[model samples]
Target chain A: MKNPLYLLQRALTYLVLIVASLLSVFPFFWLLVGATNTSADIIKGKADIGGALIDNILTFFERVDVPLVFWNSIYIAVTATFLTLLVSSLAGYAFEIFRSQVRERIFGGMLLMLSIPFAALMIPLFTMMGRLGLINNHLAIILPGIASIFIIFYFRQATKAFPRELRDAARIDGLKEWQIFFYIYLPVMRSTYAAATIIVFMLNWNNYLWPLIVLQTNDKKTLTLVVSSLLSGYYPDFGVIMVATIFATLPILIIFFVLQRRFVEGMLGSIK
Target chain B: MLCGGERFDLARTGLARTERLNGWMFIMPALVLLGVFMIYPILWSLWMSFQVGRGMNLSFGGFANILRLTQDPVFQRALSNTFIFLIVQVPIMLVLALIFATMLNDSKLWGRSLFRTAIFLPCVTSLVAYSVLFRSLFLADGFVNDFLLGLHLISEPIPWLADPFWAKIVIIMAITWRWTGYNMIFYLAAMQNIDRSIYESAKIDGVPTWARFWYLTVPMLKPVILFTSVISTIGTLQLFDEVNNIPPNAGGPSDATLTLSLYIYNLSFRFMPSFGYAATVSYVIVILVGILSYFQFMVVRDKRR
Candidate 1:
């Protein structure tokens, strides 16, 4: 089945794929190598690994309140993820199962809102936060994001694949709607939850602009805000910055790896 | 039988009422949250856009901020820079993603999964981390410059972040690197769902590879392409993280990389808190996205007819 032309095409595909992959993955590798080199060496464009990882880590920890900031990010992300999934998924399920003309219109409106840039909403949201006395509060970060339109859309789309027969059988067996959603639907859609968890958590963790505005003090900063401000310092250390960036990136990376298969499946479910 | 039928009908009606109540219950939390967080803020911002203000001292001056927006040179710069990035970068990224996706969709391709994973990894990368990596990599004496210089591509190192023109290129490259993979995943997913038999029959008809791709794979991927383009348009217009992080100042080198989102940030936070003017700039983004997306959908629809 393989002719000369076919072979040439295959070779060309392989070459492009390889180059693209390297280009895509090289920065992460550079991040790792940069963490191991001194700031001076990094400035000199040193590519080789050095034994400066410990020093970089120490420098980073000393410069920042590592535990408090880490906890701030983790708390916000986890709480936001949990609430978003619970609220949005419930709405999604309802939108699918209990469809109505009015509800459908609401759903369309939500999609349009999703397109409205969050920047557009920032000032008023900031004002509302101020009114509620939530300035410099982590709740300010977590609350606004809980009703995520994208997650709702994803869950609604994914719910299309849920079997109607299961719901029917549960109804016949005396299961209540909420009970069926909890006992049956929730268990079945664990993979979707896993996928959404990674995404929502990542977004919350890397949330820069809103958190930057709301969380005012040094002690309240997330890793993202902290890292960004770190760059603006009088003498920014790339090695220390690398170490902090790696820390900031590590949790999401680990979550991605652990749920990689489910994440892809989750994406497939949404697009369908 | 008549009595039984009447009872069944009553029960069904009762169940319908219950379902309606349950539906409201399920959606109540989201709706309430949206009301407080999204809807209210949106309305307030809309109102704010009509007012003239600095800090908290505000007065309703209808159309003042809108008029200011017309005359604001920084807004003009940011608007033009945004369009340049949108026009230049979006197509390049989308086309590359499409090409990569098609090539990878070949079932006979070896190491397909590895390549897919590698390419897609960039999208999940932390914005701060990637921005830092890119800034360093494109430094005058950094890896990218070193490699280019070694290959004799240029006689001197390019001032990627320092220069106005090159700064825009650096931001584009950064975003393209981060998001091209995300777009490719969508295309790849869509391509897989496409009937392979179409390609097989086309091959049997002695269709050239390029023709088969152009006439076949592309038409099938239209909906997905449209969806990505609209989403990408919104994302690009809201481009902040890359520009804010890559440049020395958030929107720097004389606002070369300043975007609408960044301008809004500057007006509100950096420049004595012109919330009204900031809100005005924000609406500009909304209008642009609205228009571009409408145009994109129209184009897609026209192609179908």
Candidate 2:
């Protein structure tokens, strides 16, 4: 607690930061440099780029149906993202805007549901999906998550900032509820939607456990599941696996970079 | 001012009624969908919990599953493993997150935003990607072992994913690597919200940096700390993806990483469809969460003035 010890602690703090930062960001760098190295060099801990970048790309394409896998990931992410935003935001808006005693109790119950572990319900959920005859279908992954409690809570929190005067003005202009929601509310909340899109896309794209259980074959599998299966093999290839991880992780990184500014802006707004 | 008093009151009442109706209309679809998907399945599971199962052959055996849960070895292993994960991982992550957030919060630090974003990079990484990547990086002949060998830190490779003890260590490291930054973001957000006046006063008093953090920052941010711990507790309790994906659900050479969630999965699917038994096992998780979180909530409440 003395000044000399304080200075030492400050120095220690900075040291921890640099080391932690390197440890956090080092793997991505490894993946990038590893991608350029040959399968043998990569496994041997080569940290620099080698001449195998083109071959790695070609090999990735050759072994896995790269385009199909990419498309499957993209389609699932986009569709799930869109539907989740629509359903969750709609309910979120209604929850905050329409204050009633009964609705308040319902919202409270839903919040409690948010705290339940998913493992508690996953089997029963799978049973329901099975009964609906939706096994091996992407809809099984897409549907159950559409009413995500977290996103709904987020939107409700954000909607508190929306002005009541705007709603009154729209009503005075003879705009119906649906018309106001579509033309005014929807257009005004673009940043919120962007943030939600990135988060939801990441969830859908990287979704593993559920999709792994539901999806039956290689052809139907997403990139995440493929990487999992690759690791599960008897003689796993670290070099090939690193390449797979890089490919699997790139889209989400790209998405985060493109929309990160918006996410922060939205975070400030929602939290306020 | 323009309307008669009785007419205005009547119109206001009508508008209030219509708003209530509109509210119900808007939420109806989500409510119905949730009921069918979440609420209905929960009730079904609750029912199934009562019916004893052997290979999916269900027969009503009242309270039988609950009695069986008290004696199951696998369930006991899972409960203990889950507790170990929560107790260890949450504190390590929270401390790492707090330190990182504080460091990143300093404006004098160069590349603060980049470090913040990069630190957060793991959270958005695909789970399977990292799981596979960690398994390989810590493999017997892989990068971590080779690096340690070159530096003369270890006489031999550490068998990270093979041996029971080391496998748990590798899993913990993998989890910590992936989630530390995510939690750090939460702390960073909360720290930024804190007023600068408090820290400035502490500095002016010649209070040590560690004392300033311990006495000033922590008590102020107790709510956020409590929040992170609760979420982490729930996450670690349902610790499946990392174990299942990384070690490919075999857990290890001797199943050291077998978590409650993974056990529930095995019981239901990998084993011979002991749906009733699996339900019983899952309820054990619910009970564990319920008990631990109750104590945590009490601690948080006692902290709050």
Candidate 3:
């Protein structure tokens, strides 16, 4: 029989795990329940689902340009994700396959650049964007993010797992290098792309600081900016704000759940 | 024989030339973009830091901004607040993550995936959305106070967002909530890579459970612990979203939740645009990250020896 102390420890372990899980999940539950309640009910600390979800959503829609904001977010995120993946992957593939001393030094330098926080670059980037007449444009967001150093690092790490024989075989077939990358390398490393797609999409979709600074016009704002603006109103309707929060959150949550495994793989791939 | 050798040499050179060309072609787009966005901005910011100005009226001020920083109360507040967050929140969150990761690493643990998924769920929400949620939840009459009152844990509602001290706590709690599971995932991954036989041998030798964990598991996870701590430290130093959003005054109630990043934002845009001084404030974050990361690496390396 197991000792009493061991059994007690096991029981305590389960208890702690259960508590932590509940705490982790509680806010999400509150978000949903809060969405369904009236502003007054929420303020009164109501935890149960109420009959105000439709009202809240309608109020949120009225206060914000729902379709336009979502479109803006989706358009920027999709374009940025596609460009980042394509550009970073090509660099990653070349860095690995065409390994050279000069290129290796450049790659190392780029990695060091990763530690330079975005806060430092924002002022200059803003000025540069203003000079180029790109401020408040969606391209302003898309262009700068396309060559993400972190994603490139991730792709390079994942690329190490890519088989070399396939490349040689493609070359033997007289396929040009670009054609080999498109036809052979692309299909073979689809999982890596899928993982990267989810991560980059989430990042671009949820990007706050840069967009907050650059996108000044109401019409140009993304759903994230809209939600924050909604909260800043003097009388922030909790119910309505909850709905907006959910709308902003749902797309990435859906993507995460749908591509959950690859998302996990993508995260693990980063530190490897 | 000489003609044949020259032809072979020429063929090899031709192959090398094509390979080099292809490599440059492949990497050129990303390199050019990074050059335009990252390198240019870094150099520009460095130059801008030396030029003191308000709005567009600028003049060169070499050591002037540095002197201002030493005397600036707001800058000092932001720097100290950022360090407080880095010191307090990072270790708490990382320790919790490490503990949760070890518990979840148990093969015999039931509903392991459910717990893991739940813990990681917070990462899915956008920063703004989560901050909004937390703001409502921590309001004076919000769910947190209600729950605490119900449990008889408090005699009166605590002003979570309104008070200076509690506001900082709220930001710390919000960050810890959002990132603990993310760090936990790293630890869990590293823990899984650890061979199970090490534990089995320790158990066979009658090593106590706590001793086995303390001596064996913690030592093995040292690298990951170090890695997560450094990442968390960098993240804490750059804390902005939660503080900027959660507080009613946007890092107010006497600027208790004001971070260096938020201060930089205010300097450049919110207040009168002192772009030069703002750039200077941002450099402090860069310097802090460099020093803290170096210390973390050294501490981890020395412990290993």
Candidate 4:
């Protein structure tokens, strides 16, 4: 028979794990339940799912222009993600494949730049965007984020695993440099691209601070800004706010679940 | 034969030149964007910090903004509040993450994937979405208060957003909830790479579980722990989204949750635009990150020897 102490230890482990799992998952349940309950029932601390989800969704749609904000978010996120992956991957590949003292120093400088908070850069960036007359434009949001330092760093790390023999073979076959990159490197590193796509897309989608500052017009705002503005209203219907929150969170959640393994690997790729 | 050798040498030089050009061609786009967006803005902000300004009308006043940072009560409050968060929350979150990682690292644990997925789910939500959820959940008459009262944990409902202390508590709780699992993922990844033989050897000896954890696992995971700490430190120093969106009055109930980034936002945008002062405030975060990161590295280094 197993020792009593070992059994107790196992029980304690399960107890702690169960408690943690509950705490971690409770907020999501609260979010879904809150979406279905009216403001009164939510305030009354009702835990069970209610039947007001349709009403809440309708109210959110009525208060906000759902299609425009979603378009803004989607357009910016997709364009930004595509450009970030393409540009950063090329840079990452070049950084790894080509060795030079000057380029390595520049790469080091970029790493240091990662620590420079966005708060510090916002004032000047805003002024620059204003001068270009790009204020309230989705391009303003997409342009600056296209060369993300963190993504470049991640791609550089991932690129270390790319096979040198393939590049050599491609060169021997008379494939041009850019041609090899387009045909061989791109397809071979599709998993890295997948991981980076999810990450960059999520960042661009949920981006708040810069977008909040730049996008002045209601028609130009993204879903994040719209949901935030919903709460600032006088009797923020918890139900409606929850609906909007769910709408904002759903796409990223779907992408994350679908590409869950790559997402985790992508996160690991950075620190490695 | 000499003519043929000359031609081959020329071809080698031409190929090297083309390779160099290709390298630059590949990186030029990203470099140009970074220069315009990151490098130029960094220099401009540094220069702007020295220019005393209101709105766009400005004059260079060296040390003026820095002097204002000294006397400004709001700046001091934001600075102290940020430090308090860094000191208290970072350790709590990191320790919890380390513990959860150690526990979940066990292959024998049942439902391990479920627990891991659930814990990690919070990190996927947008900052604003989670903030709004937390705000509603922690309202004075909200579910948290109702649940606590039902459990007889407290006699009266807590004013989570309205009171200063409770508001800070709520912000800390919110941050911990969102980030602990994120840090845990890093530790978990690091833990999986550690050789299982070491733990097995320790088990064969009389070393207890806690001692094995303290002596073996913690030391092995030092680099990852240091990495997560620095990232957490930087994140806390720039804490804004939750504070900005969670409280009824962004950093409200007497600025208890006011962080440096939010203060910078307020100075530049919310109030009469003090662009110079805000730039100076932003530099405070940069400096804090530099200093704290140095100390963290130093501490880790000293422990190694």
Candidate 5:
């Protein structure tokens, strides 16, 4: 009787997990399928693959400035990722390495700032960017995100795992503060950086609200903004939308795949 | 052999002072950027909230926007919709995540890494892509309706986007599908950190599986549970992308899924720009987040006591 019950429990566990996995993964599969079908087929709930991949890709590129829009997304996401990693990791390293009363208070204040919704700040932020003549420039998108409080918090938590002795030894060797950081600390924390890179890149790549408000011109839009605008039209082509989505999703997916291990580890570091 | 002048100066200033200055120096870039972008904008929004007027033209209203909030039916609908999402979707996602995490934590579980990757994949999916995919999936003649109809679950296709109540349900489903795995990853990480000996002892003592999960696991996971809940609360209160992208025209079908963030967007950008009233609506989010988070923290605090 007990053995039968145990078998039943095991069966149930597998059943639940299989269902959850299918639910999570089926969308991407369907998304790929959708990209190959025409709009009418998609509307008809076609489940099978079609041979319109080339046609969809051609239409998507023709409808939108694929190269320019993709370049805009890449430029913004890459620059923002690099700058965010530098600024936030430095602050995190500093808060941990040079602990002080004032710094602690400031850190707490920064956490409170994190809770304030970005929606509240968008209008004023837009107005401020407009004043600076950065309304259509990519810099407006990159600037506000360079000092992400969330990334700073993540780096701070990850830095807790950094060995103190390395810093002490580097100082004893007469390395300047900056030299110690550049030569020793940075080299040691490669996995943390890898994890941060994946996360920050995905965030900047998929960022919608701020970019939607800031970027006005059709020529200046990122892939995400373009995809959104495409949907807003009177007669959206599902095939084209799917193709754009696939392209929008590819970079982040690639990053996630390449750095899967470190990404998970980075999350673990933050939780600890 | 350190440089003599630099060494002498460093000694005179003292290491603490050097550390203090270095700390400030390291954080200076972030602080400057945040001050200009985050802090300045936040303060500007606060001031704007108190004023009254249309775009670019404004004057001090002294609580006029606040009073306007009371009479704004659209704002009222958005607030209720956001709360409904917060109250319903968050718990469902968290509990599902907890269950999945616990199951995945078992070393004997088959295909653990595959399951973990599959589950976590949704969170990394692009917002626009996910929204577009969901809108298609839940369309009147979409795969979801087709499947349900084939299964004899319903007689007719549900008007997912056209109906107000169903739109909210579709929004909830979309959010849950996207976020449950994200939360599960957090819980899984925390679960991995739990000492294995406790579980081993429970098994040896013949404690049932459900009892072990409830008694042993839940208590240990309280902190992360609190953390995920607080985050999900903030995320839900400021819900925008799902509703905005899923529904037509950013918030359509009679504003059934109009989140607070979407409303703020509509006011500032979509409609005749009312920056002040929009700013005022934006504060409604801040106040709600503040109150809800405080209550959450208080509840956690009391539990410890």
Candidate 6:
């Protein structure tokens, strides 16, 4: 156990791990510490905590309605996450459980559609949104992204890993297809739903380019668009931006921490 | 399972067929929305790629637009830059991810899950926030310069955001930092499927650790690696955000960070409305992704052979 070779190996692993872990956590530390400093101090590369946290936060509140923006972001994120799970999981389960050639072709078509750059379609999509008079409505942002191809693919894979016995038993019990999907499949796949909830929420919450292009008014803006405008000003307040980022990222981070066990397994299922 | 009499019976089965129709009805909403939004725009952009016009009123210029792409210096520059980012960043990120996955896979390694989560944190951070952090850190008087100066490695601070070469490097580094963790999440998930006993036996047979990794894990993780590579290639080619954010302006320092996607953005938004050319540029990205994805599929197929 005291072998010098073992000691050397442990030392090397620890060094690599420590350096990597530090690099990963350093920006987060910077974010936290920056919030405690002023704009000038942050720009000057001040590393220690300053007494500007209250001032920075107060200035942030004065500049932006923190409560409204936070609510806007959470509402959009939650609704989008919920609908995406409901829509995509149903499609995915149907695709896997009820196999058909035509649906397979439809899935293939969706896959190809996934590769089309969202930027290319933004103008047309915006035009359509405006035509439908949904411009500035949160539905304008939520509707277009309801059927995420990535999430659909994810649920399809997870469905494959599902036990067939459950479905067969449900059939024997005379549960309607919808009922079985709702009652049996959904409950057993809580872990998958958890994973999807985190990912879909993260994506919808952080979505920037589309929302920036579509949502014109300040009230319609999500946390990401708000943050983007916040930084795009003549002089970005890094301290306050850091605070906003911390707030914006907290929900996803909390979800990730809570559901990581299922998340990793879901990722494996999806990828393979 | 279904043939002859039973096949006919199932086909004529009203109740069962109604259930099957319900399946299509279930997916109909997604399909309809995607068709109007995705398919129609894609076809429209493909058409716009052909027409050479600046504004809404336009006449078809046929292949003249393609000819312009051949001669336009900025377009040519963007094409090359996109290719460069695609070629360079994908490999580095994938390799780093694979290495991290391997190290983290070793159950003997201390703090495996913690390391994985920490490494994966950057991807979860918002694009704007990460960009702000990078811009500040790479500024002339930023932490990176201070660190280098303190280490006595560089006599003067490196012009990270100024020079063209360094600008590209910074974009690549920014991308690598943000995405390597994301790709590692995939690799880590894939690697967990691998049987540990294989590695254990390899160790027992005195296979060198490096050899074991090179021979065992790489082969086992090939499919997922290909998956990450294809996605990374597409992501890098559509490399708008990093360049747009890291540079002073959108693509700054004499257009060093000017990418195809950014150039397309400039055409539609920053510059005068050249919707046709922007649509043309968007088609180029579609083509690039199509070609790259096809080749990756081929490679994966061949590897399976």
Among all windows of ten consecutive residues in candidate 3 chain A, which has the lowest summed lDDT? Answer: A263-272
- What DockQ does predicted model 6 obtain? 0.57
TM-score, candidate 4, first chain: 0.96
Per-residue lDDT of candidate 2, residues B170-280 (tens digit): 888889999888778778888988999888888888886678889988988888888778878888988887888677446655668999888888988786888877877
Worst 10 residues of 2 chain A by lDDT: A263-272
Instruction: State which candidate, 4 or 6, has the greater lDDT.
Output: 4
Candidate 5 lDDT over B1-305, as tens digits, reads: 24468768667578767777999999999999999988988889999999898988999999999999899999999998888999999999999999999989989888999999999999778778899998888888888999899999999999988899899898899999999988998898889889999999999999999999999999998888988998889999989888888876567789889889999999999889999999999988989888877877586677779
- Model 3 lDDT per residue over B172-230, tens place: 89998999889999999999899999999999999998898899999998888887888
DockQ of each: 0.71, 0.60, 0.79, 0.77, 0.75, 0.57
* TM-score-better candidate, 3 vs 5: 3
Cα error, residue A56 of model 6, in Å, equals 1.1
Q: Rate residue B232 of model 4 by lDDT.
A: 95
Candidate 6 displacement at residue B156 in angstroms: 1.5
Which whole-number lDDT from 0 to 100 does residue B143 have in model 3?
89
Report the CAPRI category for model 3.
medium
| Per-prediction tally of clashes | 0, 0, 0, 0, 0, 0
Q: Report RMSD (Å) for each prediction in the order shown.
A: 2.4, 2.9, 2.4, 2.6, 3.2, 2.4
When sorted by lDDT, best at the front, the candidate numbers are 3, 4, 5, 1, 6, 2
Model 3 chain B poorest ten-residue lDDT run: B1-10
The DockQ assigned to candidate 4 is 0.77
Flag regions of model 6 displaced more than 4 Å.
Answer: A1-9, A266-272, B2-12, B300-305
lDDT by residue for model 1 over A72-152, one digit each (tens)?
A: 999999999899999999999999999878889999788667767899999999888899999999999999999988889
lDDT (C-alpha) at residue A162 in model 2: 84
The fnat scores of all predictions, in order, read: 0.67, 0.61, 0.74, 0.72, 0.78, 0.43
Candidate 2, residue A76: the lDDT equals 85
Q: Which stretches of candidate 3 lie over 4 Å from their true place?
A: B1-10, B295-305
| Regions of model 4 farther than 4 Å from truth | B1-11, B293-305
